[model samples]
Target: MYYSRKRLMDDLPEEVTAIWSCTNEKCNGWMRDNFVLSARPTCVQCNSFMEKGEKLLPVLENANHKQSK
Candidate 1:
């Protein structure tokens, strides 16, 4: 009887930056540069290996670490 609402989330700002993309064909996974682990970063979606790539994405940050300057 009613139409569905579009765009549920807020319009987050995005920019071009380096990221890791899932290598799996059936999976769509990606992580920000400042969010991946240095030792061995892996895709959390399908547990597959990720490759470095550049894409236009929203700026991401680690909420766990306190910003102390």
Candidate 2:
């Protein structure tokens, strides 16, 4: 018998979103803007400074992250 696995949900289309990219040339660390906890976030992988940038990513929401007033 042959079987095939299928995904439960359809793949979401990618969208351009704000992000923070690692300043370290050797590091490929990045984070979504809405997911950051600080005004200026650092790279979690290499602890390097991050700069503003944009990336094509699937739509995601951080329900647990509360925005500062």
Candidate 3:
């Protein structure tokens, strides 16, 4: 019998939004704009300055955000 498990990440919504991408060619890091609180965000991977752009990435909820009662 063959067992194939489904990945939870694959089921996430593919919502397009603005994000920051690493300027460094060696680094492949990015952050969602809604998740970041900065006019100029930096790269989390190589500590380099990030560039603004849009991508069709999965929609993720910010865990740091406070939920309303």
Candidate 4:
């Protein structure tokens, strides 16, 4: 017997969210602003300085994440 699988399409809409992007041109690292624990977060992948930017991404919430004082 042969079985067929169906592909599902994501219906969530994308929203503009604040993010931190790596300053290094060679590195393509970024993180959501709401998830950042530090006031000034560095790139976790390349250890480079990060700058504020915006991106169109799916809605996400970090209810458990706490900010460092």
The residue pairs found clashing in candidate 1 are none
- Indicate the residue-level lDDT of 17 in model 4: 98
| Alpha-carbon TM-score of each model against the true structure | 0.61, 0.77, 0.67, 0.80
Number of residue pairs clashing in candidate 1, backbone atoms closer than 3 angstroms, sequence gap of 3 or more or interchain: 0
- Order candidates by lDDT, high to low: 4, 2, 3, 1
Best candidate (score: TM-score): 4
Report, for every candidate in turn, its global Cα lDDT versus the true structure: 0.75, 0.86, 0.81, 0.87
Better of 1 and 2 by lDDT: 2
lDDT tens digits by residue: candidate 1, 17-39: 88888999999998876677664
lDDT of 4 by residue, 1-69 (tens): 664443212665679999999999999999999988888999999999999999999888888676552
Instruction: List candidate 4 segments past 4 Å from native.
Output: 1-9, 66-69
Specify the highest-lDDT model's number. 4
What number of clashing residue pairs does each candidate have, in the order they appear? Answer: 0, 0, 0, 0
Better of 2 and 3 by lDDT: 2
Superior by lDDT: candidate 3 or candidate 4: 4
lDDT of 2: 0.86
